[model samples]
Target: MDSKIKISITNFITVIYLFCFLIISNGTYISTAAKIFFSILVFFSMIINYKKVFNAFSLWLVIYTLFVLSSVSWALYGEFARQSASTVVYTTICSLAIPLLLINNKKDLEFFYKIIIVLPLIYYIYYLIFYDVPNIFDLRQDASNQIYNNIGLYAAYSFLFVMIYQAEREKRNIYYDVFFVIDLFLIIISQSRKSFIYIGIIVILSMILESKNVLKTLLRILLVFVLLFIAYQVVKNGLFGDSMKELLLSFEGDASDSSYVGRMNQFDISIGLFNQNRFLGLGIGAIEYVCRFVHGQSAPIVDNDYLDILSDLGIIGMVIYYGFHIYLLIQYIYNKKKWNKKNLLFFVLLIMLFIQGFLIRGYFNNYYIPILLYLIYYDTKTLKQDDSTILET
Candidate 1:
């Protein structure tokens, strides 16, 4: 293939991968068609690069894939097991195969980041036009609405990448600052409370990472809090004050709240399920059946990723699942000499994703695994280049 053709094909694949994140299944033919298209693109890409594909596969990925595939034997629900296995395979291809094969240079990486950021900006505009903008003071807005609120989270995640990229290049400017504020606004309006908190923490960490002057950074943070306080007061007494009161009251409500109580019950059920099947647990797709039949609940998956893994995969499974991530963190730390603003941002993002996993099912989230793989590829590529340089010397 011509070099130009290869670049075009790789870029096309990158766009398709990003598009997969934007897909929202609405139980329509169009949604189904979109998913099919994405799968075909991924499958085609894998076939084209079959020889080099395994180069991207790490020991952890291999083990996790085997574990998921093996779950079929012990899975309580045959269909769910098959579906779960398929999902794992698909996600693996998207997160590892496509990027590893296509993204050969920094330009490719930047292009991926650009698409991820722009897509979320488009989503933010869509939300502003279609959805009722939640007043800042109004707390009554549903923060847990994953469907629409997730767009904001996605946007925030992408925005963080863009900022990190800029910081890495020493190119931070007004545009990034503007987008940062816009991203924060969108996150607040989306009412994804956990995401809101995560984004805030990421923003603070990014500021600290990028700042050369510690005292100035501290002053800037203090100013930020002061401004936030002023904004809070203004919104508190504004037209949305009543709605904000309702929201605050909801938070103040204790564990008796249905959502809280339900989650607690789920934790108990997951623990019980793990105890029952100590070795392998219920298998990949057994959560739904276990929840419905054993616990008399409608939810198939729990909100907590750790608990879900424990219930479905068991103690050994948990070790494999979390152990892989812990290993990655260790690797990043070991390579501290290679650390830059960009790598620091990746580390912080990984930490944020790990924290989010405790509150929500974020372990294998679309962005999380891909980011990890990208970092691994980067490290490997850099090491090879260094070795080549040493040989030349």
Candidate 2:
């Protein structure tokens, strides 16, 4: 194939993949169908680029997949176990296969970054015009929580991409700055505390990684916060102010907050389940059944990803599961040669994913695929020469 045609084909497929992911994140009616279609597409991509995909596959990923699949033998709910295993397979294809096959160079990566960043801005504009503006003062509806959460998550990603782009291009574009501010606004309005925290952590990490002078960076950040505070004072009497207040008050609530307390209980139950099982575990997809049978209504869900693995796959599973992430982190750190934008972006992403794992089940989440793709894409590019030499040897 001609190089241009190949690039065009890859870009088209990437667009489709992004669109399907957007639908999945937003909980659209056709999300499941989209997932199935995209999964098929990913499968085809894997077959078409089997050599590259095989070369990129790490030992840890193979081990992790086998362990998850093994859970089916001991899974209490066979159907759920099957679904869980299928999710693992789908995630592997999307995260590992697609990037290795389609995104082979810098141009492909830049194109991917641009689309991913713009996606959240588009979604935010739609929500602002159709939903948020009309119901600015109304309490946030439960049904809309997922939409808000998705927006916040996307916005966080947009921030990271914008920062990376700015750093790489060495240009201070006002448009990216505006987009980042919008992202912060969306995160605040969405009241996704975890997303807010993740963004803050990402920003701090980005500054540290990108800055030459740590003291100067800290001062600049302080100044930005001061400006934000002043802006808040000016808007404190309006609808936005009320929303901000509500968000702040959310953190002050007592123990009666079932959502907060429930998560804690779930963690406790996960530990107990791990203690009882200790080795292989009750199996993946066994959480709901175990919670209902063993703990009754006290612990119905495992929200933390680490805890979920501990309870489902036990000690062995947890080691494999977390060990993969640890290995990746070490690899990125060890490979750090320059304080370039790509390196900074990779560090920020690594920190965000690591922190997010504790707050939610990061393994099979929608964001997981994109994070892994970014990691793998950069890893390949950074180590291309080393990889080739090793293969030649």
Let me know the TM-score candidate 1 reaches against the reference structure. Answer: 0.76
Estimated TM-score for each candidate: 0.76, 0.78
Candidate 2's displacement at residue 12, Å, is 2.3
Clashes of each: 3, 0
True lDDT of residue 312, candidate 2: 80
Score residue 387 of candidate 2 by CA lDDT.
30
- Candidate 2 structure quality by residue, lDDT tens digits, 112-230: 77776787767766666656443432324433545676677778878777777665564566666777877777776665656666776776666555556768778768866875666
- Candidate 2 has a TM-score of 0.78
Candidate 2 residue 317 C-alpha distance from true site, Å = 2.0
Model 2 spans > 4 angstroms off: 1-7, 25-29, 55-60, 125-145, 170-172, 210-253, 291-300, 365-367, 376-380, 383-393
Q: What's the lDDT of the predicted structure labeled candidate 1?
A: 0.62
Candidate 1 on 74-139: residue-level lDDT in tens?
A: 887778778777767655545554454457677777666666666666765655555565643222
